[model samples]
Target chain A: MKFLDFFRSKRPSSASIAKERLQIIVSHERRRPSTPDFLPSLQKDILEVVRKYIQINENQIKLSVDRNGDCEVLELNISLSDPGKK
Target chain B: MKFLDFFRSKRPSSASIAKERLQIIVSHERRRPSTPDFLPSLQKDILEVVRKYIQINENQIKLSVDRNGDCEVLELNISLSDPGKK
Candidate 1:
């Protein structure tokens, strides 16, 4: 009976379950990336530079971040409105 | 003797080594980043513009040609080395 009681006591409790949930939440937050501080200024500056050459608004610029090996690649794509050329 | 033979067989064969070396050399020049003629001037212009604000080198900027479904995507990546810190 004591051995059976020992095995029952070894089972995870509500506290342990709550701790596990907390750990999962922490890990999930670690994996999810937050927006960078310079993102707004960088985007604004890039858009400004692009606008100098071609007429494009902030909405026209498409930005994407991709990973290659250990390096992170930030790609900025802008579509031009060329009337004569296809 | 079986254990000794097992340890001896752990070494890679010469043919496999040669194949690996060849694979590395061949793959080094494999993905030719063939791009448009205007790309050079565009990059130069963009870099010139970006240099006004950020002190970034040419290596920090990565340009790759990607094909997405039907349209060919031109990727431009500028690595901001942690804005506040060096």
Candidate 2:
């Protein structure tokens, strides 16, 4: 009990919690695909196209989905680095 | 129209297409975070731990989520390199 006593945690709002979980899981899946060997090429292609709009942080792009009955919602977390004093 | 005629496409059912979209979106979201500067340390920590269980493909780790009413489901694509013919 003493080990736990030092930390006080508050439950997060359902939306925030869901968003957080979504970000983490999407990161994991993107890095590990069904076919592992082909990922490097895929990454290169993605990065090349992605660089046009934004300088990707290379570590924060996560993609995922939610199935609502028959409709599927795609969730993308587009985190951008500091615009660098622009 | 001729350019379009060269391509033949079949409409994917809501399920298969959803999965494909989910994978791509998750990949994007994981790479972009609310806070970009903190991602390197996160990746390093995750990789160091993940190396022991499996040689993570590194390029495919997409972390994401699905919010079901009040519950958040974490979806992780755990892809591994060939088990090395063990």
Candidate 3:
């Protein structure tokens, strides 16, 4: 009986459930805002800078802007393959 | 000669350098603004709710508020332990 109870307890915890709900809500909030007019130019400039030194596909770069209070944050994530391996 | 050049290429690429630079800049930007006044209370309330259902350490939960233009986003991340293991 104890073993059966243990197996049954495999149900997801409340914390996981809360996290899933929060992710959905946060992603929705992130997508609701229209991108700023300058974002495309910004991305293009950054991509050009990166391309000058490395051979990378377009998918390797990501750029996003997030706001905190009145402050704006530009976040860039780039994945680079080792040049030697290439 | 080619092998020697290959070993020398192990030096970090421009993309890696760019990423490191961006991380420093973004982290600085994230820290520049003072946290909002209501954030502590909000975290406490959420912690209380989560604690009601699971045994989790304080560090297991993370909460942050980020803004995008006029929109505000509350990001919550929680790590849950398997109840059966406990």
Best by DockQ: 2
Better of 2 and 3 by DockQ: 2
Order of the predicted models by TM-score, top scorer first? 1, 3, 2
For all candidates, what are the clash counts?
0, 45, 1
- Expressed as tens digits, the lDDT of each residue in B1-86 for candidate 3 is 22122222332365432211111111101221332233334345544543443455656555565543222344454443232123
Best by lDDT: 2
Candidate 2 lDDT, A1-86, residue by residue in tens: 11111111222355543332222321212222342333333434434444443455646565544433322333344444342212
True contacts kept of each: 0.01, 0.07, 0.00
Model 1 alpha-carbon miss at residue B32, Å? 26
Give the TM-score (vs. native) of candidate 2. 0.23
The alpha-carbon deviation from the true structure for residue A43 of candidate 3, after best TM-score superposition, in angstroms, is 2.5
Name every residue pair that clashes in candidate 1: none
Residue A79 in model 3: lDDT: 42
- For candidate 1, write residues A1-86 as lDDT tens digits: 22122222333465432211000000000111331333335445645644444445545455654332222324354434231132
> What lDDT tens digits, residue by residue, belong to model 2 across residues B41-84?
34444344444434456464655444333323333444333421
lDDT of 3 by residue, A1-86 (tens): 22122212332365532211110111101111332233334345544543443455656555565544322334454443232123
Candidate whose TM-score is highest: 1
Query: Which residue runs does candidate 2 get wrong by more than 4 Å?
Result: A1-36, A57-78, A83-86, B1-22, B26-86
